[model samples]
Target: MTTEERDQLRRALSVYVEGAPTAPEWQDWNFQRAVPDRQHRFVTGPVVALVAAASLVLVVLGGITLLLRGNIPEVVGEPVTTMTVAPSVTATTEMSLPTGPVNPAAYADVPSFQGTVRYFQHDPALGSPGWQATVSVRFAEPMRFMYTVVEERPGDDDFLFLGGAGTTFIGDGTQIWLDEADDLPPLQTQQPGFFRHLFYDSESPSPAWNEICGASPERIGVETIAGRHTSHIACSTTLEDYELWIDEESGVVLKMRGPLFVGDLHPQVDRDGGFEFTEFAIAGVSIPEVKIPQVEIAGFFPPFHMVQEIDFGGGSVDTVEYWYRDESTWRESIIASSAPSAVGSFQLVADGQVGQCILEEDLCSVVPLEGDRLLFGLQLPSPTSRVPLEFVGDHCDQLAEETILGRAAFHFACDGVRFEIRGTWVALTDPTVGRSDYWYDKGTGLAVKYTGEGWSWDTQLLELEPVFDDAIFVHQEVEEQASEPWPDTYVAADGIVPAWSGPLLDGTTLDLDDFRTLPGSEPGSGGSFVVVYDWFPTCGPICLDGITDFQKLYDKYGTTDWSVTGGPNIEFVSVVDDDVSVAQRTNERLGITVPTVACFADEIDPAKGHNGLCTPDSPWSFWSIGVPSWTVIDTDGFLVYGVTGRDYDFAELDSLLADISGLTES
Candidate 1:
């Protein structure tokens, strides 16, 4: 197929499966990113393994993620499109208000939309994520756009470089760029998926934006923004809902309001006043009064910190801190613990970087990141959500108004929730949540209580502040009267995946030591090459296909009797970060041939798939930040190669096998 055709098919499949990097880019990254052995380093003397552990930079994201490469095409890809990002609460359009209901879905994402939209933010705490932008777009086939922010605040112009005011970003469905000026060669260029969260795509769209379980939006009249008619539409995929203002003539979303990629949303307006579009028309939209979409959030959204006491049954109760500052940066610290600082005591996340420290050992490690994401399949909702019910999915029923901890709250009957604390995650009120009660404060939207099954727990909001201390955000701190841990600095080094062992879904133990024996030095003859396949339960179609293809890989390249005796060539193991039960269900559903494990027994499962113990800094050491990654270990027990992401192909394994057994020239 032609490159254009492949790209087209890639876009089509991206909606179904989380995306992969362009084939050539991924192929180039396959081994180039892995650790290259210096002759002395591998000459069999004790060498210091950098505590950083040669961790590869990879990002795990929902929907789709992209990593571009090489040079740019002078001519755009097929159906290339443009886009901008930002949202406000509510605002009056300059044009006369129109009559009747309009369906934003029908006009989901149309090509060729260029307009300037006014931005309004009423955030008292965060001040405002960003100011408005005057932008123009042609399409998102590879969504692209030219953008610059409208400065209303003192530093509102800072967002032209991305500050609290908001970001100035645009993408041509294929290539995405941020904080670059026109009339200059692009200083920054990223894969289309990199800036995806900023603009809603128009082509081969995912169901999350346009269709919410086939639910219909409430058409609440139409307003003319930028002299063009727009439909104000609202809908809830669940208890939490969102509102969108779409161009009536085109499906281009004028302003997206509701939740800010919030796993949480509320019935109440996020905070009012939004973008007011002033101009409309294409031919590379000039700043003609700049007609733009202003997204008006409902309430004050800000960075925050909260302390809660969680009872983990037994005499073991733990105190956890939840801190969030934008989605890119945050920290989870355990000031006091019932048990010992259970492995990786403190974790600091900023953008793609995750820094973990074990105070007891004076050891710390930083894992490089690839994109906008969090580790271990965890979701960090804006602390200010009026009702952060995104994780509740649709399995919830509203309950009567109630008071908890002397604060007004909204109750719900739903399945249990999986909350992350320390290195492990737990399902509070799981299974029986449908019959149980979960309560959250009306204003803060923080869960105060959960009563379900045979147990009950309540969160003591010892403190909920609208602000985050900048000092705590530092990766390495001296730990003097701080929320984070001590000796945060002093990075350590270690070679070889830590003596990793975990329980398979069937409850069998998998020890890396079991596969380290090498009978002979003949190429492809002996010395075990353990191939580890990483996956998460939430991974999309593309990742699922990789797992399915793993079966074929095993059949052709992997040993047939490794389980019974030993395999000289390859031993394959698939791992999930969640509970083994979940992996069992996945195996049963997909009929995977590769043995699957859930990282640990049940105590510390991953968010949805991240192996809590296999964090890039851990012994099992695969980056917890990526899904569907491939890591190869040589008989010497060193992680020699890591392939971040690419569509599944058995041949890739063939190449890895060649590398591990020293048969590259063959």
Candidate 2:
């Protein structure tokens, strides 16, 4: 190979093979902390967020969004006053279930209130210091609220994000409307109301709702909270116990204490933390007009082209190429397969227009950017810490300036910040909210460095000149190979199989009923495992990598360890559809001693690209969904798991292997 070819090969080898961040380090990918996905492209590389392809946006929150969750419709408006919940507070202490049901929905349409509240979350047993905050809050009719954080106290954790503190956020259901302020965070102008997540079905909601709630509050009594006559109620659930002090007249909850969880996403966890009103009263809230923070990015922005290198700590690395044409236009491309041409790729880029598509299988989704919600779609991330600092509600602590990669960069850090993805709610933030140290290039305001737990990456400036080509800012069309994956044909087994047969390379016809089973499994599910590797060397470097891996795996055959305490059962098979002769030749060439199977194009079935293991009349198709795919089957002809990617999901495969190992342990 020429030097150029060798360089390309080396880059493709190092760049595209490992996409996810390593475990216990950058393992909690920041995807969950962002909005849900529109059309997520399965990445085959590292935590490098690339948007050159139209699939998913790797938001600063951690990972990509694969699923979406809609907000629960609020039962507000009209101020329904049919609430007749008059409970006699005869019992002064803890008691059993109350005869009078204390329904929270009954108070849902009650008078709105405004007051100062205090809340906290802590669990010494959870092995980390917790958080506490004090904020003044006000809500007027449907979707008008002014939430101002008075204080944020995070204990013992440098990465502790005091969410939305120090800034009075005014929202009329969506977008930040904070008044004009100098040097404040940018207007997280899109989907700003995501902080108010509704996780329960309203009609019969969980008693844990922070709104006019529902759910059975186990016990009822009377107490005064915030100087209001209240019915102090307590609840008991399988997880923990909680209490609430509701207004006797209005049905509004005056105070509440319980385990903190919003439809399952709970952070600073393992303990119940709650908030209560120090003072509250019925009042009409006046919505204020707040201005988006103006970040100083004139000379600092348009930092041009740069490449970010992410070290996965396991001798593997990936790079994120940035093409920042200007402030409003930029692209993040993580060359999953190969770059410059960007095949087998996943990236983020969009035209200045609103949108184009939202199909999950499509390579691109131009999610509508209504206003200035650039970061919402994994657009260009600003060099200013204001945006992230606002998300975490931290007062930007300007750290000492640092030199990174021979460039002077502004240094700052946030405990954590949840990036917003509008209308997509697969999951919430908190899974990967680690202390993140950020460094911005002083001259360009480009994020030069981002370091978190156990892992770190650097953005080295390649060029600082303006990208003159307007075509570079234009989004690329979806390619055939880079689109969504092939349909998953793997199915669960029912512990039974037909007497189907296929030709093995040893000139033997192996029937489903002919294999031996593991010791503890059912008698005749065609017993021994047929670990099938679905690839041949003709499939390029991907297939070559698979063949090499298959060789290592095939080595386990006939060994004491392979038998797992000497049961003498599991089998390994390599499937090649080229031809029986081709299979033999490839196997010999690759030194693949494992028994090979020839699944040549069957005349009975229409020709397809990959006609794997020709059990033509069998229920288990066992076909290669994608070249370099692999599947596991029991002695029975049933699919245990199937991985259809350029690279195997080794962690998932390891888990399946362990499960089988446990089954054969006896």
Candidate 3:
């Protein structure tokens, strides 16, 4: 098909899967046809092995015979050690109830309400396969619980399942097992673990928890649910501010709120706001086990445009919700918005830290500035197209507000923790198109809330805590090396390619077999100085600048003993489109025509992919402007010089070029 027709087809598909795939045209078949890699990584990992072991322990305790079964006492009566890195919390030695009347009736029938759990998650980031939301947990008799994650968002034609049960811990008289299956990598698993250790522990020193879920031994007022009264306890933590309803008589937890992504992503806008359970059942039934696909989040959205719908074409689309500590709620409106640029540099921060920031976006650091104003770097998106957006700051403010489901919200004020500032985000399209609310408390600045159509997660401000030893709140840019200008210190050789091979950029080509080095035995090696110029056809300014620089370098150093060559522009042409071999041939035909420096300009082999031996430090540094380029060979055919773009040193080039020429420094 013609490129124009192909472009049109791609655009049509992009628009078709914007909402619930209620249409037959976009079915499972189409979903399978779309997503990049269909394989699921969670079901086949070392982590899953732990889950299986947990199940085996439970079975052995009950005297069940299985190949993987363990000793009954070791599985049940024996202590199951749990190693955790938790925050320090100071507590009184005595366990006293809160200053309130005991509501005995509130704790009834809590133990009987235990059963399997099932749920789904939706994300606004349409690119992710929806596996984070939908969750199902099956509690073993007294407390063993096995949970499975089935299906993800973006609606895949087929569902991936993760098979496993949760760990067991003894609480009061009943054994308890909480399903924690969201440990899949590429999903920010570490962040969740950080939360678990900080708040859940009563020994945690962080006072945030007490503010949300009132401390134990202290009785809180009672609340009625489903014709039964229950004791309500509220607490908050830096990671997750939560509340728990306990059956006063059974001490069983009937309902809970605030076990979600916290920190900047979930600022405590309203600690008073929380989630309420609508229903409860105590039954064991097998829900379909689903393996969740591992998703890697590359970058963040620009500070504009509220996302409306994320089209996960098939069943891959799963759970979607907003996790924010806000009292104003969310509303819908017809707002024009612009999409952020997609071309971005990919870098890995440490092992788990992965970031992809635009080259032009402003990045500020925490280092003190000499002046009142702070200087920062900007990472602008690539020269690609951006989504159009009309900024509307106050459009449908009242109508667009809605309460997020299943999210726990909290608010806080501490001595060291303070908010720097908060502001209304206005998209570029219109000064008043969309409004974004940010919260900052103490050492960690603004706690930002992130939510897309069907996906949502809160980035804890403290999770990515800044280390001032180097710099904080500053731009993290990878510095590139710079090499000397080319050609002035380099030279191109003619008859570089075999005459029988074909035509070169400079037109004429002759057999290089006749050439000899100073030692006489090495062909084209004795007394010959060779340099390789690197250039890319698609690298616009950078490539052009490199070739021009190399040409000039050769002019100043050109001599009977010096020769240079560079691969035809075809090597630099984007391989995404044309065939490599065809492009290579075409590049040789046009390499010399575009630009180059040669000893015998008419005898150079343009058909040869490269002008000469790819030299590293012969003036042109490929590492700086392009990938890796420039390899210089001496009279003995030994590589004597090499350099990569941006990182090349001019002094080093001078030394290498002199060495290749067999000339001593003046």
Model 1 TM-score (2 dp): 0.31
Predicted candidate 1 versus true structure: per-residue lDDT over 397-494, tens digit per residue: 78788976677888887655432111111124334334667787677666667676543557665354556667766766533233222111111223
Tell me the deviation in Å of residue 111 in model 1.
7.5
lDDT of 2 by residue, 479-567 (tens): 54423232233242343333345678788776656565645777543356667776644334567777677667556442234455433
Predictions in order: lDDT: 0.44, 0.45, 0.27
**Model 2 Cα displacement at 621 (Å)?**
32
TM-score of each candidate structure, all chains considered together: 0.31, 0.42, 0.22
Candidate achieving higher TM-score, 1 or 3: 1
Candidate 3: tens digits of C-alpha lDDT, residues 1-666: 112222322221111111221211211111111112222111100000112222211111011111210111112232222222223223322234445543332222223332222221122222332332222223322222332322223223222222222211222122222222222111101111111111222232222333345444334445543233456565433223345555455443444433232221111111222222233344333222222222211122222212222222222121111111111111111111111111121211221222223221211112322111111111111100111111121222212232232223222212211111001111122232233332222222222333323332243222222222322112366322112222112222221221111133344442222222544364543344455554433223443445555544454454333333321111111111112232343345334223232212222354642434222322222222223245454443334454444444545665655544445555
Q: Which ranges of candidate 2 are over 4 A from the true structure?
A: 1-110, 120-133, 141-143, 149-173, 176-219, 234-240, 248-251, 262-273, 285-288, 293-316, 320-331, 336-350, 354-364, 371-666
> Model 1's lDDT to the true fold?
0.44
- List ranges where model 3 is wrong by over 4 Å: 1-502, 510-527, 562-628, 664-666
